[model samples]
Target: MTGRPATTTLWRPTGPEELALVRALDWRAWPPRLPEQPIFYPVLNEDYAIRIAREWNVPHSGVGFVTRFEVRSGFLSRYPVRRAGGRTILELWVPAEELPEFNAHIVGTVQVVHTFR
Candidate 1:
């Protein structure tokens, strides 16, 4: 809880807008939220991300993005978590401002797995 929580490397699937924003900001960072978006959600694993991308983002937006990044696992505690699919995957909601700190913890490059087009 003091001086940055323990970190873990994790992957998050992103949406087109988030993809564009992160790209504009560089892989090392995440962008600010829109007026209506109080929280920024990043899923906990590749399987979860892919599901969201395919089932939700792709169906609705026609494209979904997959991104890999590292962040503090403990930091996730401060947010609300929704575990699904027999707890094989989860999602966390982070306030917009906290995204900067989250992005700073990335261990390596944030890669685009592919667009689910």
Candidate 2:
């Protein structure tokens, strides 16, 4: 309630090419870690993180929220969810020029998840 609104993009993937882009981005941004495999946590690559923002179904002025969970003592603990919407959760701001490319990646990823599975 004290700062300016953030910006974002919402994209829906339509083809395999787009999906491949998204997957590539995801891999680049968040390389997999064998140590963390027990929890099945997705270590999203930076590129994929951007794609997630573009693919998120929210307004341009919305804020993005990213969360990480850890299991301890046979219990799952959740990180706090940010309240702002339309904002990307990454540490750096994604350039406007890259929005289109990121959106394409997101759309492609979604398409693959929905149809190919």
Candidate 3:
């Protein structure tokens, strides 16, 4: 083994309001979901995230952002990858209550990789 820490990359498409909450956390963690939101989804591919940010988030909120982050590979294994639509539309569904544990497995600060207005 190369001896580097194992991590899996994930992408999240977010609106300005949600982005604000993430910023409030110093980019170290994602904010808890609202009462009606039962799951926190992070996509497995950047293209899927970008599509959502541009088409969904921007249209609804006037601004959208695609954030990328890494999580410990082992910790992520418990959540099976889910295909939302096409083959590339893959994501991991973390239950709302598990978000704190999920945040703890993040390998680094969340980063904005793309933005749409």
Candidate 4:
């Protein structure tokens, strides 16, 4: 696929508050598909996506800056090094049409680095 540069939002969890956001994002992104697990899945949800974007704008209380990159489809598989680093993170892929909401869920989680261009 063609490649292009796009901006994304990221967040670094520092404390409980940050962690809570991550948890919340996880829940939103992947709301409980089953009754038993409920909010434990890793699936992507529209609401969660929006939350990620919102969290990206907030100030992080941990190391490294939450960064997002909008690239083509092959970008992720090609640039593993640049995306490497940090611990305890979550990510989700959103279609271009739902980018706004997807971004919200991304930032709310832990450290986010999006690549959708």
Per-candidate TM vs. native?
A: 0.76, 0.22, 0.96, 0.21
lDDT (10s digit) by residue, model 2, range 1-117: 665223222222223433354457662222222342322222223344435544651233243333221112111112232322344432222234433433333211232222211
Number of the top candidate by lDDT? 3
| lDDT (0 to 1) per candidate | 0.74, 0.31, 0.96, 0.34
What ranges in model 1 sit over 4 Å off? Answer: 1-7, 72-81
Using TM-score as the measure, name the better of candidate 2 and candidate 3: 3
Write model 1 residue lDDT over 1-117, tens digit each, in one string: 457456755667677887787788766677778889887777777887888778888887888887777776666556677775568687777787777776666555678886798
Which residue pairs does candidate 3 place in steric collision?
A: none
The sequence of per-residue lDDT tens digits that candidate 3 reaches over residues 6-110 is 999999999999989999999999999999999999999999999999999999999999999999999999999999999999999999999999999998899
- What TM-score does prediction 4 earn? 0.21
Candidate 1 vs 2: which has more TM-score: 1
Model 1 weakest lDDT span, ten residues long: 1-10
> After best superposition, candidate 2 residue 11: deviation in angstroms?
5.5
Minimum summed lDDT over a 10-residue window in model 4 is located at 37-46
Backbone steric clashes in candidate 3, count = 0
Model 2 misplaced regions, further than 4 Å:
1-11, 27-113
lDDT of 3: 0.96
The CA lDDT at 114 in model 3 is: 96
What's model 4's overall lDDT?
Answer: 0.34
lDDT per residue for candidate 4 within 61-109, as digits (tens), equals 3222222223333333322322122333344333344433443433233
